[model samples]
Target: MQRRDFAAALTAALAAPAVLGATPAHADERSGGGLSRRMRAALAAELDDQDTARTVVPYLQDIGFDWHPETIAPERLDFIVAYGFGNRPPAGGGDPAKVLPEPGPVNEELADTVARIRRRRTVPVYAQWEIARFLESKYRMKNVTSIEPVIAPDGTITYLSTDGVAAQVAEARKHVPGGIGTAGVVGFRDHVKRCVQTTRDRGMTAYAPRGFEMPGTYDPESGQAWTRRRDLYVVHDMAAQWQVLRQKLIAQAYPNG
Candidate 1:
């Protein structure tokens, strides 16, 4: 799809009542099955739209996928929270040390951004899982705390999620004066929205930088290699968004659960 056409579609989609984030009143009418089916049908339609693939490329670029860092006023932030990316252990067992994941490209980028921001003005940074360790050991960042994942006795990570991280941050904020004030949510460009939303759900006002500045003149949607990479990133982002919606529907259906 042409860039202009993609923008139009996106604008229309945003204005639509059935946009991804809106919750229907009857979401739990069928024990969540009603909303689930509706979302599945919407996703099916999105998949069938030929322009979706082409449009997503530009959408990601517009959303700062190429890493145009935002102007962050550190003084406004009470604290910063960095989310983990691809830092989970493998499902199939292997050497524990080898299976332990290090920060991926996204996390590394987040670390670098957070580290730079810290240099300007120091603030407490709470990172999930290995990111906390990475910041402390590699960047030597002080006052960095790790939000550990819940692990079952069988060695499986039971509750390593964005919501889990935000919950921990919310609890910790109780000690901070003014509590849950403005917070910086650091993560990949595409993942930042969900991070900000989850953080807000936990009662913290959150904002994410545009992301690490795209080094030099590299355009993520221009070249063939970059285009393919952006497509994959968009696909993964869409799936992640779907998961968030699914979880929201489940919660609405079973608030006690």
Candidate 2:
């Protein structure tokens, strides 16, 4: 799909509440099934892998978690996820059946962290602009005074960077003299954090991994958004992963029903 077309779809998707940090679109519902005991056990094993632990450890730190870094293992993290569609195209030919409805299960610990830092339940309407545009508008709005400010010699303000991530800040400052916000602001981490948290809180259980910068094509006739998805960074083997979880639920009848 053309970049412009995808952008248009993204704009429309963002018109509603955003599920991903970049934009929000309505996701199809997950099947009315729960994870089975054995499937849960397998999922637990996958989540416990060293890579998963490594990925989540930094996330814990980002969210102000106070656990011992070494002791922060994936086994302890909760995988009870909220579901959503990836809004991207799959590898090989894009398959509509393969397109996910929401993000995959996140560690419950992460969800709890988001709840603590949350200022409000929802975010702003214009929160999904491209990073540059967002930062440009933010600097113009002067809402970033609290964080360290970068001003040009001509007194044109450019961008703000938190004390953390000094390298990014310095690189951004390089362009300050040109009156262009040389650096993207450091606040979007919070936006992404909140986006994941909000997605989880909304009861989404699965997610398709797509780059936040990558745009997908939306076919109006088919009513599906298609992205040229490269890899399953979010959940390796999403179909298999979900199938395992789904089979687990399918094997056991509901306790009451």
lDDT of 2 by residue, 111-196 (tens): 22222222222211111112222233433422221122245575553432111223233333345454322111111211233333
| Candidate 1 TM-score versus the reference | 0.58
Which regions of candidate 1 are displaced past 4 Å? 1-72, 88-99, 210-229, 242-257
Separately for all candidates shown, the number of backbone clashes (residues 3 or more apart, or on different chains) is 1, 26
After superposition, which runs of candidate 2 have C-alpha atoms over 4 Å from their true positions? 1-33, 41-139, 145-230, 235-257
- The C-alpha lDDT values of all candidates are 0.60, 0.27
Residue 189, model 2: Cα distance from true site in angstroms: 12
